[model samples]
Target chain A: MSRLDDALREALRREEPPEGFAGRVMARIEARKERAGAWDGLMAAWRGPRLRWAGALAGAVLLIGTAAYQETQRAEGEQAKRQVMLALRITGAKLDLARARIQRVGYGLGDR
Target chain B: MRIAIVVLAATLGTAWAQDIKMPPAFDKLAAKAEESVDVTLDSGMLQLGGKFLSDKDADEAKAKKLIGGLKGIYVRSFEFAKEGEYSAADVDALRSQLQPPVWSRVVGVTSKKGGEITEVYFKTSNGAQIGGLVVIDAEPKELTVVSISGAISPEDLADLGGQFGIPKVELPKSKGKEAK
Candidate 1:
């Protein structure tokens, strides 16, 4: 009976905590709550439409920039095509001159 | 059906234009040239340019037809401030790129009076279709190279003559059979 009582007392006795253990625990709890609050705030801000709107604006700007670049490239290509036609015309005229001259002399130009 | 045909033709045209190889050295001469013109048009640009051609003008209509199957047109012309700015070696370098079986020199016209030399070449494939054309004209102070890729006929080109500053090329009359 005494042994059972002793065991009960031992089990029920309050033990002394290590020094500053409660301070560490309290600090940890406070720090965790602060971190959680900050995270919560960030999540709320992200969930708002401002970030999404910003994202959409950025995408639109990028698309406009790409379209502008393509337009410039196409313009340059068109200019190049015109220049090509002109050059070919000049080339054809020159070849015609040579051929006409050769024909007038009756010395036929060589063929393939 | 017509749309499909046009799409197919455009696809084939683009495919044909990719075979040309130009010497990198030509850029150096272009810089030194007093007057220079450089043009490179791929299939896409050709089709786009075709839209602007006048339907009423016979010359434009003929050019549109001539360029129907053409994949690409590349031309480079350089007029120098003085003679001898270009070298024979540069010309030789360009000439070496053209070889037999795939390419054949069709015509050589030399005029001593103006100190001009012109050589025309046709690209042959399968003995049925001419795939490309080249013209190299060298003068005392000017040099020009024209390369057209894809299936273009001599007559189609001749159709574009007498207009657009293309002095009408009187092709030698066909006798017996045909020269081309």
Candidate 2:
């Protein structure tokens, strides 16, 4: 029984801790906090200017694409307008010539 | 079978009455010409071009109004470096397509001295109304064929003769400048 009591005393006895144990624990906690802070900064950087740059790039591409389409349409429309004008000019010229000849014939003028 | 035949006949008859096909000889002439102007504008292209024509300009406005109901306009003008590059047979091929029963020669002017022949043919639709017009202007060194298909009136023809850069042709006052 006494042996048992002595073993209990030895097991439950309060003893002084080794030197710098609390400092080591505090240092470990500080290192963990620094690592967490650095990770948060990296995430914040990704969310800030990097996301904005991606959005801006997408918007620029859309704007350029729309402008190019409008330019193509304008060019084609202008070409068609030119063709129509040229056709009208040729038709008008020929018709005028025919009318002139008809008038000359009506006036008893021979084909000169 | 009878109904199908009737439908096909009607469609073909309508097409034949409205459009004049330029002969393949014109393509050969185009290849040989020094300078050629070939303009073919269908209904869709005309509509697109008409949208761009400004309402403010006088000529553009007139042109836009003129082409409002037009189905197509095809013009082929070829100018050779010299005379005799094209033969009379080429012109005959075009004239053959504009025969009677659907087409009638409205005006024909031939100048032997200047070696110029101009003929205008009108295609009739519904017996009286003009459905299309074709103009063949064959000069010594130039050949121009203008075919406009649509509902065109005599007033429209007069407008074409008067405006759109067609100088009001005045009778020669004792051979002054030969009417340009």
Candidate 3:
């Protein structure tokens, strides 16, 4: 542990680069940056004009689909309500007719 | 999903042990008719409709009350392009479904003016309460059949009259008097 500490302190001491050492180090850094693969280079590329528009279109489609789906459900509910009303209307009309007949029968039976 | 919930409620809440299924023979008539309306609202549909019915709306309230104890409502109506598109055999087939001891035709009105015939049948359980009713309105160019299965009565039906496009009913004098 003492040896490691001594090495770290020695390395940490103020140091000056040899004659063109700074230039060499910078050149190495530039070369390493160039070696970064095409995938990484493409990833860092500027977003194209159509990319944002495509994202917006996809978002719009998703929104419309959600709205349409909900609208369809609502429409179905409304249609169900309409059918119920129609069914009741028919029922009421028919029942009224039958009731009228029964009434006539009743009056006849009573007079008899 | 919402429909599923109502359907489930119908299965549990309504007293109907079984929903009256429409006969397959009726399918053949659908293709021949110019316009057909086939509505089958089981206990679930009724119960679901009952939920949206407002006491403030007289027709809805009346319909709601009328269907409260109902198990199902089935209506099959067809309008043909011409007369005699259907025959008595078809009528007899439907009438046969109403066999004896259960359904009795309380009224059959034949109108010469419109060449229309309307037959009404009722299923009586006790002496007073009617359990179900069927209506068949046959016109020269149209046919309408309605079946209501549930615990019902003439008075219960009378309750729906005077509104909802149902003409003012002239209830029987003696019995109507007692009913009120």
Chain A only: TM-score per candidate: 0.52, 0.56, 0.49
| Model 3, global lDDT | 0.72
Give the higher-DockQ candidate: 1 or 3.
Answer: 3
* DockQ metric for all predictions: 0.13, 0.30, 0.20
- The C-alpha lDDT values of all candidates are 0.74, 0.84, 0.72
| Model 3: residue B37 alpha-carbon error in angstroms | 1.5
The C-alpha interface RMSD of every prediction is: 5.0, 5.6, 4.9
Sorted by TM-score, highest first, which candidate order results? 2, 1, 3
Question: Which candidate's lDDT is highest?
Answer: 2
Q: Model 1 clash pairs?
A: none
Q: Tens-digit lDDT track for model 3 on B1-180?
A: 999989977754442344334557678888999999998888887776677677898777777788887888899988999998888778777786664456677767766776777787777566577778788888899888988888876666656545576676755556544222
- State, as a TM-score between 0 and 1, how close model 1 is to the true structure: 0.62
TM-score of chain B of each: 0.78, 0.82, 0.77
lDDT, model 2, position B136: 96
In terms of docking quality, model 2 is acceptable
lDDT of 2 at A92: 87
lDDT of 2 by residue, B1-180 (tens): 999999988866865755788889899999999999999999999998998998999778888988987899999999999999999999998898887767878778888999899898988778454788999999999999999988786666667765776675654445333554
Weakest ten-residue segment in model 1 chain B by summed lDDT: B171-180
Better of 1 and 2 by lDDT: 2
- Tell me which residue pairs clash in candidate 2: none
Cα lDDT of model 3 by residue, A90-111, tens digit: 7667656555555543541122
